[model samples]
Target chain A: MTSLTQQLVDALGIMVLGMGLVFLFLGILILGVELVARCLSRANEASTPSMSEQPMPALDSRLVAAISSAVHQYRASA
Target chain B: MDGLMAFWAETGIAHFTPGQMLMMAVGGLLLYLAIVRGFEPLLLLPIGFGAVLANIPHAGFTEEGGMLYYAYHVGIETGVFPLLIFMGVGALTDFGALIANPKTLLLGAAAQFGIFATLIGAIALNLVPGFEFSMKDAAAIAIIGGADGPTAIFLASKLAPELLGAIAVAAYSYMALVPIIQPPIMRLLTTQAEREIKMEQLREVSKKEKVIFPLMVLGLTILFLPAATPLVGMFCLGNLMRESGVVDRLSKTAQNELINIVTIFLGLAVGSKLSAAQFLRQETLGILLLGAVAFGIGTATGVLMAKLMCKLSGGKVNPLIGAAGVSAVPMAARVVNKVGLEANQHNYLLMHAMGPNVAGVLGSAVAAGILLAVLG
Candidate 1:
């Protein structure tokens, strides 16, 4: 092939190879991050109980009502 | 009387040529654009002043023994200065936007079409009378499409030293004009709805991921395209210094003192190449035309690619961010945000556009490496 022909061919090859590699490198990066995020979320899940699994302790209704009444009365008086 | 006459004959006015006067005027124009117009003053100021120095009659500024000669030989010819600039750029870059949306790398890669397309355009210009560009010259000229000034200078110095002055000037001029050049193409390609499309907020990238990112990119480049190591390696070194958090001093030095020092030498050396014989040719006009085309094509393609992705992603991606793929750094991103805001008052695309903006840098570097591998 002539030198020009070779250069044209080389340019084509570069376009393909370069673009392919860029996508590949970035693809691998995306996959790696997804995996890391997945693992992190799993670790957190294992360490912490679900909201349904760990409920809050109940309070005395009469004491709660008295406190709410006192706060409301104090604001009204002020 | 004879001694006085001899001294007068030796003065700059005695030996000045029309070409030199024209070039000095051109230099003054560049200075005006830099200082008054605020067009890339950090670079164009030194370059314009150097042009004046180079063109002064009987001055040896560009000759073998001159300061610019040494600066050119030490930095630009050796491809050290541009790499140093890249290192500084890396130090300043935050890849978190890209990391949060790796798919944007494709937009970066897609923008490189401008370089290859302009290569063909450079070669095609040979058909015009008084225009002749070899493959190497075309390669050098085509890199202006990369939209990265230092990369253009580096590749031009290596491939076509004769065209270095025109190529560097064209590259930086277009870079400075990005705000003006990109918006129209971006608006023309995308509809108001596409521009107004809001993207989801990017997830935060972890510090560990940030530290690993540059090393991984460097390793991949070394493995696949060793020719790219010079540019990519220095870039990764600067990035690693920044991301590692252990080398704050080194990163700051690279980003500030080292880069500023090299920019002065690099600008002067590039300006030295702007002497009359090298720049006053049909090829210079061709280079400028081809460079504008390249930038336009890169911007258009990036927007089109984003439109395609927007369709595929069910409109999750805004097409305005595509223009950022031209790699004018935060400037292109800012344009995207501004244009997007014009369409929708509440839509802010700055952070999203940054993903493709930084990706364009890496994309261009890789494209330059590929060209070197093929033609160097």
Candidate 2:
């Protein structure tokens, strides 16, 4: 029952509202993705050194001394 | 003699109308396109077969108690099939490319202008004597521009069930023709230098980021546009299952078996709508024309946005990747890469084009949401 003029006007309204919302939504999504990536990278950076540093204590002092003595003997023999 | 004549009257050939015959031929052409030309064979083959089945006089295939009637009502009419298909697509898709380069989302957003542009075109077609599309009809027709078949079918099923056959045909046909249709527009929109621009390598996306990406997208959709929740929600669920890595069994089924099963039913259900009474109309022709215009416009706008981004980014971005924003999935992305190769053989834009290509899927879903929210 709506006239052609009315339909055209409504179509234009949808076009504007639709495009504006789509852009705004996607733009915010971009920001969200960027923030997530940055935070994950930062978290990885913060955790990595500690992870690497943890293995040091797991090695017994006796094992370290034996390895060091072996290295020293090998150098002397060579 | 009376019994013999009665039997003849009951025969299919005796009851055939020219319209039914024409529709059958159309179905046959669709079959040829699918089997011979390999145009979206998975969907077109079933759809073509369903169309043939529907048109047989007195077969009652599309009647109230018919199998196709139940198929249409249970799957497409309720809008479950497309959402299920979206979930499968989500499971199959890899978001690492989009996550690596989020700026291409703008290209995805820009390409949806084609939907809106075609909306007005559909409305304008009313000036023609035989064309009389309502606002809902126009909205449904315009979504063919999105270039995502599920979205097109979903929107058509929702907003304009009568136009479902024409819109689905136009959408899938244009999608199948993406390689041929998009390259010229992509080339026409960008200079050779712009086409040959080599993008920087995308950084590796960590597992944790991939896990959170779908959740974030779903959260935003829920907050801002709940209308899109059905489509976006399923997509996110599938992506979450895939990326969570703990649900490999479920993800594989969603990607393969579940999707394959739904595709068969969805194709047949959609084909049922192609009865002669529904499809042979002037409006159908308008839908086909507008669908192509929508696709062309979407491609052009996507490329133009890429060109703008290229200008802003100091030529580090290739504009050809913009055309992939039409969201024909890997087909559109592959077309971008092929055209990019023509300009520079060593330059592979597949990974880069994927960022916008996936974004195009999201873009069309959001656009469909907007249309549904506004009109439905």
Candidate 3:
């Protein structure tokens, strides 16, 4: 027969093992949520008509110039 | 003339034992390591000084209730110094990265594999001649792998006080040697491609989340593992002191002056335990050997766990950060960043690794408590 000390040791081992497995599971679970969120957002964008069909909203004049400059640089790089 | 000679003979001390003389030399070596190598001088200097004092021919400082004995009773025996140290650690630690990237908690959990594996190995070592250890002793010895000094002391104090000197010395020594002990294992475990993997930027964690995190951990620890209450309680108190921003003076004291002062006492107390009788035993050598092996395995396990996550996440995670999981704090995290940079200049893993770095401290404390509750 196993001593009480042995039994307690066995029980402690199992509990610690359980805790480790839980953390591993939780990491994967969080990653899954991020992946799902990214996928759903992409799908929503595909279903909608392009926003360019509507007139662009008015922006601060400085902001508009800055946006155009950034676009121009990006296009040159591409 | 005869009376003067008699007085000199009576007042003088005896010649040193071979053991005491050798320990003095060892003490000098530790002093050199601290001063020259810049390895944990805050603790090692005091510990080395204490060893010198204790091993003197007739100091009797380590006698029943001397100052060194009292220091042991007040600081280490009752487990106050370690808790106070934890408080300082909490203040020094920024939980922002950990709270932002909670998934890194797994790396911390995975790192503890070394502790339990060492326990098994230690128990098995008892089968050899000249070494005999109980479960409590094995557990205490195994905690050296956790790489956190206070957690090792807290557990050893409760589980096996006699071995506290050897265990605490081993723990602190290994902690200082982390940059040396860890890198080779890390290199061996990862391929050039894996080492060169560049991870994307981590998301920004809000200040509010960082402020609330210690409170949450403190609450969970109190409810679930009351045995861990002292460690969790003191650490949370330090974190609260730091974040509350109302008591900057006390926070600074805990983080700087108080912890530094207590580190001297803690180190000296630990060093006093290195008498030839206690520390020079065959079991001490076995503990050191097993501790190193356990550390290697823990590092490997943490890396493997990160590789698995990399696979699951389609290689977005950097496996190098996994080495920071063993609770040497920012040092381990900094090493991760340094190694990552060596592989690729642009790859910085510092902030990313801190998530698991701080988490590993908590993981080791919890593991220590579990061992105490079960093994003690």
Candidate 4:
């Protein structure tokens, strides 16, 4: 083949190889990231309390009323 | 009287040629563009001054043993300056947007079609009379479509040093003109409705993810394309330093002082190549014309890719953000955001566009590596 024609063929080869490699590399990266995220989320879920678990105990009503009355009395005085 | 005439003969007035004068005017125009027009002043100012210095008749600025000659030989010809600049670019870059949505990497890859297409166009230009670009020259010129200055310079230095000046000028000029050049192509490729599409906010990427990214990319490059190590290695180093949070000082220096110092020398070295005999050629015109064509094609293809994605994704993607695939960094992304806003005032596409913007950087680097591997 002529040198120019040979070079053109080489360039085409490069285009295919280069573009394919880039996509493959990035695809691997995407999959890796997704796996990492999934694992992290799973770990987080394991560590944190699930919604089905019992909620924290309610605050004492008398203490809450006392605090509220104190705040109300203070505001009225001001 | 004979002694006075001999001394006068030593002056610039006696040694000046029309070509040199014309080069000086070109230098002044570059200075004006940088200072008055605010076109990439960080690079254009030094390049403009260097061009002026290079054109001074009988000054020996671009000759052997001259300052610019040494700068060119030591930094540019050896291909160190562009690599250093790439390091700085990496330090300055934030891959958060790209990491949050890795699919944007496809946009970056798609945009590189411009580079390859332009390669064919440049080679085909040889069919025209008064134009003769070798395969290597065509490769160097075609890289201007990549819209990444350091990549263009690095590839030119390696493959076609003689064409470095025109190629660098074209790359940086097109990068600075991204706002103007990309918008029309973006508008033309995508319908108004497609442009108005709002993308979901990118997920917050973890610090661990950011830290691992550079290493992963480095490993991939080493395995697949060792020829790209110099450019990709340094770039990843800067990014790792930035994301590592341990070498804040090094990252700061790489992005600021180191890049600044390299930019001055690199610009001057590039400008030194703009000597009269080199710059005033039919080949230079061909380089400039092909550069625009490459950039336009890249921009259009990027938008078209986004349009395709928009279709496949059921309109979750805004085709406007695809223009950022040209790899001009935040400039191209900002243009995407602006154009998107024109279509739908409330749509903010800056962050979305950034995904493809940074992806474009990696995409172009890979393309450069491919060219070097195949042709070098």
Candidate number achieving the greatest lDDT relative to the actual structure: 2
Off by over 4 Å in 1: A1-29, A32-78
Ten contiguous residues with the weakest lDDT in model 2 chain B: B179-188
What TM-score should be assigned to candidate 3? 0.84
**Superior by DockQ: candidate 2 or candidate 3:** 2
The positional error of residue B204 in candidate 2, measured at the CA in angstroms, is 0.2
Q: Write the per-residue lDDT of candidate 3 for residues B1-376, one digit (tens) a residue.
A: 9998777665525457788887778678779989999888887888888887778766687888778888998888899999999999988888777766777878887888888888877766765777777778888888888889899989999889998877877887888888988889888888889988987777665454555667767766665667777887899889988887889999999999999988989888888887767777777788788888778777777888888888899988888888888998878899889889999998888998898888788778777766765656
Candidate 1 per-residue lDDT over residues A25-70, each given as its tens digit: 5566567656665766677679676545756799899999999999
Report clash pairs, candidate 3: none
Two-chain complex of model 3, DockQ on C-alpha atoms against the true structure: 0.08
Give the number of the best model, judged by DockQ. Answer: 2
Q: Which pairs, if any, clash in model 2?
A: none
For model 1, residues B1-376, the per-residue Cα lDDT tens digits are 9999999999998999999999999899999999999999999999999899999988888898999999999999999999999999999999999988888887887787888888877766666778778888988888898899988998998899999999999999999999899989998998888888999999987787788789878877878788888888999999999999999999999999999999999999888888999989888999999999999999988899899999999999998888898788988899999999999999999999999999899888888887888789
lDDT of 2 by residue, B100-142 (tens): 9999999999999999999999999998898889999999999
What docking grade does candidate 2 earn?
medium
lDDT of 3: 0.79
Give candidates' CA RMSD values in order: 7.6, 7.3, 9.0, 6.3
In what order do the candidates fall by lDDT, top score first?
2, 4, 1, 3
> lDDT per model, in order?
0.88, 0.94, 0.79, 0.88
How close is candidate 1 at the interface, in terms of C-alpha RMSD after superposing the true interface residues?
Answer: 2.6
